[model samples]
Target: MNGKPAVFLDRDGVINEDRGYVHRWEDFSFLPGAIDALRQLQQKGYLLVVITNQSAVARGLCTEADVLALHERMCAFLRERGIELAGIYHCPHHPQGSVSDYAIACACRKPEPGMILRAAQAHGIDLSRSLLVGDKISDLEAGRAAGIPSLYLVVPPGQDEDLSSLPGVQRVSGLSEVVERMFGSQAMPSS
Candidate 1:
């Protein structure tokens, strides 16, 4: 397959309000302007992919099936709105997790680049031209390691993380800001 550019997104905070360890459809809420931003990005010819680390499974807070169910619902919700995701890759491992099966330090977790690299290969994505948008430094590191040149950090309100010192990473208030900056007002498509 020919290589195409993609926008790698972090699921929790970037697409939905990260109500810590969200594993149920009832608890999921799309962030404001997220749907429109996704629609615009897709209209611009970028494959949309989600690369996330779901430690809740390892922590025993939720089962892997629970996470998968949530993701299925999320994809359906987006598809109903005309935004189709190229892929959704999630890592369910943590070094200190309580679930032995998913507790080992895995390569697919954020800061490891395993998921992004795998996604690029599986989807024929051109890492050199792709972009990643996430709310954590680990997300940026993963994208960078996967050779994605553009990285965006979504700084939610009241977020205390100091990411200003990080070189080569741009900070935005939310998905809307990222969309506005990338496409410009003139190129923005109506939702």
Candidate 2:
């Protein structure tokens, strides 16, 4: 906490309900306990950062501006709750994108460490002390690649991701469990 260790979060599924490339504010919904979890982490003095991949932009489902607008909406919600974000980094590129400008194999995409690394540089984050929470394997991979010490997989109950073989990665059923696992259940979320 003294050195600006960050809690890097994936946007979809981790923060918002992932209803297939959700880009509009109307479609956005905070996952249960996400706000509380984030508030708890923030109270512990961890920088809250979001690193996500929005391939929907590449597929023309939405524009980059739409993605930014969605992030603004998310931040607005957090601000209303008295929480602040350190940074929001997203990659709109896809290797097989329909849009030529985003078609290349970009390093910012998840499973790669570009976005997280860049955010660390921009926000003075200590990657060695950082933690990442994501809902998928690729999210864990990105944290591993970025040299983050911890990775938490947020999977629903009865779902076995079978990722136990991986070192330093733990699985949690929800964001509340994420805060519990890292900081113990006694660490209550601040209002």
Candidate 1: regions farther than 4 A off = 158-160
Candidate 1 has its poorest 10 consecutive residues by lDDT at: 157-166
TM-score for predicted model 1 compared with the true structure: 0.95
Q: Could you tell me how far off, in angstroms, the CA of residue 162 lies in candidate 1 after the best superposition?
A: 2.8
Model 2 regions more than 4 Å off? none
Separate clash counts for every candidate? 0, 0
| Candidate 2, run of 10 with poorest lDDT | 182-191
Best by lDDT: 1
RMSD of 2: 1.7
Measured against the true structure, the TM-scores of the candidates, in listed sequence, are 0.95, 0.95
